[model samples]
Target: MKILVCISKVPDTTAKIAFKDNNTSYDTNGVQFIINPYDEWYALVRALEIKESQGGSVTVINVGGAENDPTIRKALAIGADDAVRVNTLASDALNTAQNIADYAKKEGFDMVFCGKETIDYNGSQVGGMIAALMDMPYISYASKMNIVESKATIERDIQGGKEVLEVEVPFVLSAAKGMAEARIPNMRGIMAARTKPLNVIEPSNTDYMTEIVGYELPPAKGECRFVDAENPEELIELLRNEAKII
Candidate 1:
């Protein structure tokens, strides 16, 4: 079972987000980057678990430039046997997915896994796109998966409950919470990752459907409005007029 786990580089959750170039680009200066939380904690870990049980390999893939190498190294440290960096500047979801799908198709991986969405972009499209590109079965928001023989049993989160799906090998799945527990890299793992194979590959020609014109932070919060607990009239008026709760 060769599992290809797609990881993403994202700003650390605590990083302060700001825009530059008249809000045309993110101001990465003074910001810390990390492996996307969902990818690191759920998707990659789940793939590692599957590999441990089935005795195979887990490879991490990312679409980014040199700036993302550190986070890619981190993923390798966590348990991925190797890493592949699609050398590109594209941050668009579609283009990224296309590049990954192209690589997966040629590599002939048995399973491809990705997080439900990257924390930074919050675009839940890659897994489905890859499945579409490969014309393979797709299971999004999968919280659990088990492989038996040549088939896979996947449990996905649906609107109100969960859905279990059985699909053949060579499929794509987007992992969400409950897939697996997060693992911090140990000293041996970290040291070994420094020398692990990190292949850099150029993305095949793929037309980008969109480009980011700019980025803007959400508006700052307004001054807090106090509610009078002893005065019922004030509370009602505030809710109806100011807060618009009614």
Candidate 2:
């Protein structure tokens, strides 16, 4: 099983977020970056688990600039055999997915894994886009996957229950929680990662279907409203009319 796992670099969850240039760009100053947790904890770790059990190599791929190299290296330390960095700064989902598909197309990987969404953007767009561009089957929010020979059994959470599926090789899946437990790099693994191969390549396409207009922060918290507990009708009305939950 030759597996390809997509990696993403994102700000630490505890980092302070701010916008710059009149709220058009994200501020990087004083920000700490890390491997997107969904990618690291679930997708990448699951891929490594497969490799350990099935006897094949795992390759980690990312589409970003030099700053992302360290993030990719962390994946290597976790247990990937090699890494590929598409040396491009693509904030657009279409372009980023396109870049990954362009490389995976040439690599002939049997399985492609991705986190359900990045922590920063939470777009949940790239995995599906890559599957579409590659003309491959896509399974989103997969929480469990088992491989035997050339067949794969997968499970995903749906509205009320879990959905199970069977697929062959050469498919894409977005990993969710419960895929695998997170693994921290040991000292030996960390030392080996320094010498592991990390190939950098340029993107095949640079054009993007969309671009960011600008970013605006959400509105500040509104004042609290009190509803008379004596009247359930009033509480229902407040929830429906004000909170809009129903």
Candidate 3:
């Protein structure tokens, strides 16, 4: 079983987000980048778990320029056997997924794992796109997966309940919470990561279908108002008038 885990570099959760070029682009002046939490905590960890149990290799892939090397290295430190960095800017989800699909198709990986979405974009589209490009089955929001022989059994979230599925090998899955526990890199893993193979490849000729015209932050939150618990009528009046819920 050769598993490919798609990882992404995103701004740290605590980093202050800002825009540049008159709010047309993100400002990365002093931002700290890390592997996207969904990718690291669920997707990558689950891929590692599968490899460990199945006696195979887990390869991590990222789509970005040299600036994302540190984030890819961190995934390697987390226990991937190797890494691949697409030497291009991940302008949009479609382009990134196409590039990954191009590489994976050539390598003929048995399984591909990706997070449900990237924290920055939250476009939950890459895994399905890859599956389409590779002409394979796609399972989204997978919380658990078990492989026996050449068949895979997957569990995923659905409205009001969970759905279980079975598919053959060579499929794409978008991992969500409950997939696996997060793993922190120890000193030995970090040292080994420094010597791991990180292959850089040029992206395919796929262009983005859409582009960001501009960005604006959400409006600032309004001040809070407190209503006495004893004054139920006043609370109802406030809800009907100021809050406009009634």
Candidate 4:
């Protein structure tokens, strides 16, 4: 079995987000990037576990520039057998999915894994896009997954209950929490990662339809205006006028 795990590089949670170039772009200056937690903690680790159990290979793929190499290497250290870096800086979800789908097609991977969503963008579109591009089955927001006799059993969280579905090989799954545990690369793993093959490939020619035009932080919170708890009319008026809910 050949499992391909798609990893994304995102801003660290602690990094303050800002924009530049007339607010049309993210301010990358002095920004810290990390492996997207969902990808690293659930998707990649689950792929690794599958490989260990089933005797297969796990390869990590990333669509980004040179700066993404560190997080890619960290995934390698956490047990990905190898990695492919598509040399591009395109952050649009559709373009990134295209890049990964193009590579997956050429590689003939049996299974593909990605995070439920990136923390920064939260688009949650790439996995389905990749599956559609590859003409394969797509299962999203999976909290648990198992493969048996070339069929995949996936469990995903829904509004009030979990949904379980089964699909055959050559499918895509976007992993969420409860899929697997996060791993920290130990000294040995880190040293071994240095020797692991890190293949950099030029991205396939594809047009990006989406672009970041501008960004802004949400407005700050206002002071709370407490009302008498026993007054139902006041609450109704507050909801109808101040909160605008009713």
Candidate 5:
């Protein structure tokens, strides 16, 4: 089995987000970036587990410039056999998916894995777009998957329940939580990652379909108001008038 895991670099969850350039772009200065949690904790780990059990290779791919190499190295330390960095700015989900799909088509990977969404953008569209570009089946929000002799059994989350599916090889999956346990890179893996291959390729000529105009933070939260427990009528009045929920 040849598995391709798509990874992304995102601002650390606790990083203070800010906009720059007249609020048209993110202020990346002094920001610490890491592999997206969903990509690292579930998608990449699940692909590694599949490779370990099935005796195949797991390759990690990222769509970004050289600055993302550190994040790519972390994926390698987590057990990807090799890495591929598409030399381009991840302008939008569609272009990123196109770059990945272009490479995956040439490589002819049996399975592809990606997080359901990126933390920064929260656009759950790349995996499906890749699947469409590759003309393969796509399973989204996959929580569990098992492969046996060219067939794959998958369990995915739905509204208030889950669905079980079966598909042949050569498919794409957007992994969600419960796919696999997170793995921390040990000293040995870190050292081994230093020697792992990190290949860089220029992206094919593709134009971004969308552009960011501006960004604004949400309004500040209002201060809390206290209501006396003995004043039930007052509380009801407050709910009806101030809180407005009735």
Candidate 6:
């Protein structure tokens, strides 16, 4: 099985987010980046597990500038056979998916995987877009999968309960939580990753279909107010009129 896992670089959750150019873009200065948690913990690790059990090669692909190489290296250390970095900073989800889909098509990978969403944007659109561009079956939020002889049975969450579905070899999946456990890179893996193949390729398409208007942080928490515990009706009024919960 030839598998391709899509990875992304995201600002560390603890990093203080700020906007630049009048709040039109993210300010990356002094921000530490890491492989998106969903990508690393579920998508990439599950891909590695599949490869280990099925005796196939796993390749991780990223769409970003040269600065993304460090995150790509981290993916390699987690047990990917090789990595591909599309040398382009994608402005939107479409172009990012387009670049990845183009590469997956050229490589003819049997399976394509991605995290359900990126922490920074949380769009949860790239995987579906890639599946569309490649014209393959797409399964999102895949939690568990069992593969045998070019067929796979995948489990995912539905509206109220879990849903299990089956797909053939050539398909796309966006991994969610419970797909797999996260793996830490040991000294040996880190050393091997330094020599692992990090293939850099130019993006096939650079046209962006979307633009960022602006970004703003969520409103800060308001001051806490107290109501007399002995007066239940007053609390009800507060909830109904002030907090609006009722």
For residues 128-227, write the lDDT of model 5, one tens digit per residue: 9999999999999999999997999999998999999999989999999999999999999999999999999999847999887899999998888887
lDDT per residue as tens, model 4, 91-195: 677888899999999989999999999999989999999999999998889999999879888999878899998889999989999999998999999999999
Candidate with the larger lDDT of 5 and 6: 5
TM-score preference between candidates 2 and 6, better one: 6
Which parts of model 5 have CA positions greater than 4 angstroms off? 228-237
**Higher-scoring candidate on TM-score, 1 or 5:** 5
For model 1, the superposed segments whose C-alpha errors exceed 4 Å read 228-237
Residue 100 in model 1: shift from native, Å? 0.8
TM-score of each: 0.94, 0.90, 0.95, 0.90, 0.95, 0.94
lDDT of 5: 0.94
1-246, model 3: which lDDT tens digit per residue? 999999999999999989999999999999999999999999999888888887889999999999999899999999999999999988788899999999999998999999999999989999999999999999999999889978999999888999999999989999999999999999999999999999999998469888899999999998888888888789889999988999
Better of 2 and 4 by lDDT: 2
Instruction: Compare candidates 4 and 6 on lDDT and give the better one.
Output: 6
Candidate 5 clashes between residue pairs 3 or more apart in a chain or in different chains: none
Best by lDDT: 5
Clashes of 6: 0
Of 3 and 6, the candidate ahead on TM-score is 3
| Consecutive 10-residue window with the lowest summed lDDT within model 4 | 205-214
Please, what is the whole-model Cα lDDT of each candidate in the order they appear? 0.90, 0.92, 0.93, 0.91, 0.94, 0.93
Worst 10 residues of 6 by lDDT: 223-232
Listed per candidate, the RMSD to the true structure in angstroms reads 1.6, 2.7, 1.4, 2.5, 1.5, 1.7
- lDDT (Cα, 0-100) at 133 in candidate 6: 99
Q: Which residue pairs show collisions in model 2?
A: none
In model 4, which runs have C-alpha deviations exceeding 4 angstroms? 224-246
